[model samples]
Target chain A: MTSHPPAEGLKVHVLPAPFDPANVTLITQGAEALLYRTTFLAPSTPAALKVRPQKPWRHPTLDKRLTRQRILAEARVLVKCRKEGVPVPGVLGLDWEAGWVVMEWVEGWSVKEAVRGWEKREGARQSEQERGGYEIEGLLRRIGEAVGRLHKAGVVHGDLTTSNMMLRPLGSGGAGQAEESGAGSLEGEVVLIDFGLATQATQEEERAVDLYVLERAFGSTHPRSEGRFGVVLEAYGESYKGAKATLKRLEDVRMRGRKKNSKDYPPAVLLLTDLEGTVAPWPDECDSRTMHDREEKRRVPACLQPYQKAESYTGAGSNPYPPHAK
Target chain B: MENITLPHLLEHPLQVCLFRNVENATFLRQQLLDGNTKFEYAFLDASVLLSRKHVLAACFRAINDMLNDRLKSRNVHSEIVFSLSPNNNISESFRRFGITNESINVLAIKVGGDAAQIESHLTANVKGQPAVFSDEVLAEVCDLSRIKKIYRVDVGTKSDGEAARKEAEAFVLGSMALKGS
Candidate 1:
């Protein structure tokens, strides 16, 4: 449906478009929306605007409420990330109905593309004077460590993939070439993006699923999965040194699920509910199968008896990770 | 203060009104109190020699009128206005006026000094913000003679101090004349 001021009267902020209409260019079109690169005249700066459909379907009552909540939640996540020195865009504007946000656009390639090119360059046997290859393994390790920091802060990104990350010049003052090899470790600075699906999680289950999703994403997208993904785990282990027990339990959960013979993958929402601090209420329209599934988990086999005693229980099932919550 | 630009002034909740006398002002106050409207700063302008109740009522009515419109609309609601006045309760007044997170603007015109002081006060407060005053309001104050006389004066509420009212009217009408012609 075409977006027009509704009969109820569309509420607009009355601010002029920051960028000249002619200057704004469409960058990408995905399932949800289209992105545009625009230059906001006030700050004389470049910004990115994500434009979503604005008709009734786009801003349906339920979707609008959810979208508004997501925007607020993402802004809060970004604020937390910024405080912890994560490199994400600075939010400029939030127009909920318009489904648009203006943010300081970072100029860089995705980590996914960076890793691919790194491997490609290394195999080419280029001259030493040639443009140095971006350290692919180091980049993955940095991503893992960043995720580790996030989990420490009690946040599960729900979606964490290389495509959602951006790598820029490592504090080289501006967007300049790499001057020193170790002066700015390529792994030293990486920017995380897209926290739309993120939620607070204090349990190992939710955090583990988040990492699992990323691992699977990497395996599917990147050419070398085994060795490259190992580097990511090593760095993650270093960052989450105190929580090895939790990681071990996550592996156990993965193994158990693997043997279940169920082809259906559980949604992240279900996993988030299993986290200690996360308490997800059943969906309003949950079917009979979900009710049965809930009943099944409620049974709690005695095989988990010794496991339950060793862990400091958080009422139901406690995570065996670091006892202290950040 | 510097001139309030159209853009910046748009950020605040603003309102404008036209009226004849004390009765109108009184009527307005009853509505505001009924509507639970409040003002941080106000400029209620009417002839001092006339009934004080009507002038106050008109100001309150104008404010009440502002809130009836959609709170989220770009146009200012007639309910409240804001300036950088140090009124202690002005912030609270903003809430009473139904202005959620928006800025506030209100004015109470003093009688008998230079009526033009209203313009100066508005000018000072508007510093770098924009305000849109109604043409009808300008006509009621006798500022605009060029626009064909539209509404017959409601005789019941008309006041005697036509000259000072004319001076106040001139500011809005005069600016419009320059812009239109």
Candidate 2:
């Protein structure tokens, strides 16, 4: 599928080296990042390359720092999930210096599309009985299990939306079968995607908020299937040992109201605080021993250490010969 | 020589040759150490290789790094060997994946070389039986114990063979992609 045209002036910046600009297709543009469906390693192996473009409005140093932190944070979380056997995309490759990450391209439709399609078909047929049947229940259960697995792994997807979750058909099953089965069938494994806003937290309040966000997403996106969302909670409650407490906390979160707007805080700032601790106090000082010392404690992977150091020293300094200049 | 153009890099074709029961491994290592231009190739120990994908992943990484001007080693040939390693140490990577005196099966790779020239060069330098560079052949020579040790994967006893191999491969690819980070 062809992606929407990228915002003005972003076309040149988002393209990485070694890839012909002709081959890169912009999949979607979000506030913080642009999703491009491209090939990685080989032309045959499709990958989703998310590029956090350098924000011209912000200070160059701050922009670079945030871009690096968010890219690394997302890659780290995806790697952690893959190792733990969570049904998330494997991180294929990443270049923090370029502000991009290439992940395994999942082949399927989003849960939002599938659910809406199902609801539309069911509404037309007035099949209330089939609506609450095993097919939909199974889908909800899988969604619960996937989310539970994420939480169990100590990660919370800060933004939980149906659009962010995909319904990947299982084991060689064609997408044709999923489409043929109608929207209500709910056939396929629920795979979570777009962990850009995700964080590593096991706190009850955080988990509750995560669930509440999904609940709100479900209610707004698929009102017809709103009644069946409880099935998701039922399966989630039994997914892990701590899930029960998180469910109990969800009640309190609902009463208190979901007030925190992720948009209020700079995405990079939120990601940095979540992944590491506080942002380095001195953005200007090239040698922040405390920053490096703290990062070292976090076991910053060997490959990323150099970039971290470079970001500290250079901090938004213009490249002597930028790739685009060539 | 089996000349193949990997998916992403159509311009830089690779000439590959596999040899089993190699007797001249020490001489091959010496040639590489002396920086002989003709011997500029990735001479990998086949026992450490899991499959065609395993070797190709390293090749892909090396070429990708070279294209991005991010070579951490001397050249793309050395970078290919470094790509196989899960850690960041360059010499350690060469020791783990590159040719050694004790290497019994060798997978020699030369990028962008004449197919006939590479085949003749490989034939003259190595004393071994030429083997088809295929995953099936590599499977027979691959030492699971050594691969596990090098990659540090357990492949737990309870898991079936297919599942265990898949798990190990997933871990290996993840490690390769995250080698420096």
Candidate 3:
């Protein structure tokens, strides 16, 4: 979850249900949900309460139904993951009508913070430092496997970033495995969180996109560790049955890129005609009666013509189509 | 009887009493069926409850529903039983969680009532020895197999022992919390 300064105006929206603002401390002001650190079930038991406030601009009925669906969707996905033995925070309590969901509090720092901390310490000793230690590789591998397990359970986390994963300290959790823990400490299970955007889908394309988003996120967020990202993919490749196929699809996703860059076509490009091909289209403002009444101006690549000398046609007899379209 | 006030639910403090070797289970169940106002306590069979937190979670939900006027059952006491349920069926919840005629261990809970009145009334009515209300004590009284069957958990094949139990509890809590959604 992207953390920002708590929106002061949001503090005015009293917490839904019995949770009073006085008792629930605001943790972050996300674009969609307001997260709070509060006690649920019992006073000593800590929980994360996510409140989706009402959008006053929408009709009250629609707003309520929308909020309820979102809350239920997140909670249902979380419960399913927990039942499948996925490392995720369990849903402790949920009040969809109140637009709030309380989840078991995951302790320890986020993977983003942990990685950055490691990077900072490693850079300080750069003179004799070796890039990518065993611990770091293990951590990345763990992250990959955690994600693989989630996907294997037939769910895709729409947003897969380091910040969304938590490193719950180990050893205390079970019996064995007293691993080393000091500087660049990554000794914990990678617990994925934030199911707000997750969906139940086993299609390889969606899974590939999920991984693509993570790859891009990891590269941009931790450029220094980008080189070791391959280790994560390698681990993910072996984690499940269709994982290799998903990785293969990841190659195609990378080629297309994340944005719809079709608009960046040189000056003018062919807009499909006489066909079912449909997408963002240029306005066809001229009617049958007005086709000859209006002068049509079109863009030509600057290489061929200057902007001031752009070609203009008063009627359909002149060229009919732009040179660029051909 | 112990006075328990949950966080965010201080307005509805609870008075809970745990009983062991209850011989009057039939009588208590009868009073509830008779709709006796004097027995306005949430009489739960401790066998179905995993731990103190499990029981209190139901209490918190029931009280919150009452506060918001969303109680699905008759009142807060019956609502507590319904809250323990993982579905919207009220009678099924009562049948599974509510005190049974053969219940050996019983948990008597009174919400927002006179503490002295509840304690005296419970002691005079419930024909059993009062036991400490603790997780360890509840663990002894709780039947893991019954809990697994009720929550539909396959904890036996998962991990076994404390880890398995913890996993089961998390799933059970999740199911209970997400009920009716």
Candidate 4:
């Protein structure tokens, strides 16, 4: 009966005040937030509504505080990123008391969908598929540049994966073709989204960890194209003055990850059944996190790890901004 | 007068009327400052308004905050003017975004009133040519330099056209949304 009713009998389906159910359609129901596609300002302009419903499992005050803090944090980072010219969704509106934030609706397919679609089509092409190499590689470079720009702006996205990146196609057909074809063409700008676990940090370790997380994400999902990730590193190395140093630090982070993934370490207790949206824990929650690096080194399916050495990128000059992880 | 009913807040249907080349700016602002109940409308200087969406967004915030009893100003009308600001300074917001004695293009917004009655009152009081409330008209009236200085954006340097305008609008809306947070 109340807006903040006990979670035992409450359903998040009931949107907060000012949002009519008839107007907003459910986009995706994530663990914390229920994303909705709705029009804002005018009927024609689309926007994303992220609502953090009460968690009945936790204490009411704590749950409310967490919800408020996270919603504000995410909004703040997004605004800061936008002001700094990072390609992220701009915050259209936010209501911390209502546990909701509305953002500009990104119109394009996810990089995950695009890359997977291209891979699927490549298999179909058999031998002649080599021609598509340039396109896919270009997409990788853009991803690298996007992350670099994000880091340059002094925010680290804790969870970095292909799924978190969007390919806003250059042509007029981007949004129209989102659901139809991810395999069609890979020409677009890489816009990062879902900064639920992002932090405002400039430490090299945090930045390395961000890159390391992305590296693992790519390695796990698209093992066949894992080596091509180096192109991402290369482009990132050149994006800004501090990018090269960050790349150098990425090697140390990778070494530590490899050490953790070694065969003798607790027999890999962490089993991620669904690799998609596997969030890299925030620094405070690192102890409770499950890190599954099973067969990380043993599964060497490819031969060329060319350009994989991040040390070569150390020539990046010093920058005057704060920096973030994978 | 254009009767604009936002999708979500249908209960608060707005009666909006835009005016161009206002002949008496000082008289209108005087009524607001004098606290005339008859002139309890959001008298906005249309030069700072980027688009129809910008005006709608401010209205949405004002009305929504009023519904939730979170209004920071005198009333919803004043709150609408405050919402247009990128920061919290109620009176300053009034000075910057609100109608001033020098305002030429003025936009009159009434949250919920009889369309014909409000139109008649505005026509009788305000001395300006009534213009359709549209983006094209707003674009013509918008002073880009003032907007850039207020929002602290490089909207002036980038001449990439429509896309750039939309991007600037996005930042402005974002700033307004995150104003009090």
Off by more than 4 A, model 2: A1-14, A126-132, A173-185, A258-326, B154-164
| Model 3 TM-score, 2 decimals | 0.83
Worst 10 residues of 1 chain B by lDDT: B172-181
Tens-digit per-residue lDDT, B41-106, candidate 1: 243332111222122222322332243332222223322222111122444333333222222222
Q: Please provide, for model 2 over B90-155, each residue's C-alpha lDDT reduced to its tens digit, 9 standing for 90 to 100.
A: 999999899999999999998787888889988999999999988678878888888888888754
Please give, for residues B1-181, the per-residue lDDT of candidate 3 as tens digits. 8999998887889999999999999999999999999889899999888878788889988998898899888999999999998889899999999999999999999998899988889999999999999987887888888888888886563226667777777888889989987
Summarize candidate 1's per-residue lDDT along A275-295 as a digit string, tens digits: 535543443223334556553
lDDT of each: 0.47, 0.79, 0.84, 0.84
lDDT of 4 by residue, A83-149 (tens): 8889999998888888999898888878888888877777777577464677799889999999999
lDDT string for model 2 (A1-326, tens) is 12567677744564555555567777998988988888765556678888888887999898888998898888888877877778888776667877877788887788988778777666677656665545667788889999999999999999989999998876522346655654434687788999999988879899999999999889889877887899999999999999999999987777666433334222322334364545553342233465465534444334444433343333345533212110
Docking verdict class for candidate 3: medium
Model 2 is docked with a DockQ of 0.23
Question: What C-alpha lDDT, on a 0 to 100 scale, does residue B168 get in candidate 3?
Answer: 77
**Clashing pairs in model 4?**
A201-A323, A202-A323, A207-A324, A209-A326, A210-A325, A210-A326, A211-A326
lDDT of 3 at B174: 87
**Clash list (residue pairs), candidate 3:** none
- What lDDT score is found at residue B179 in candidate 1? 17
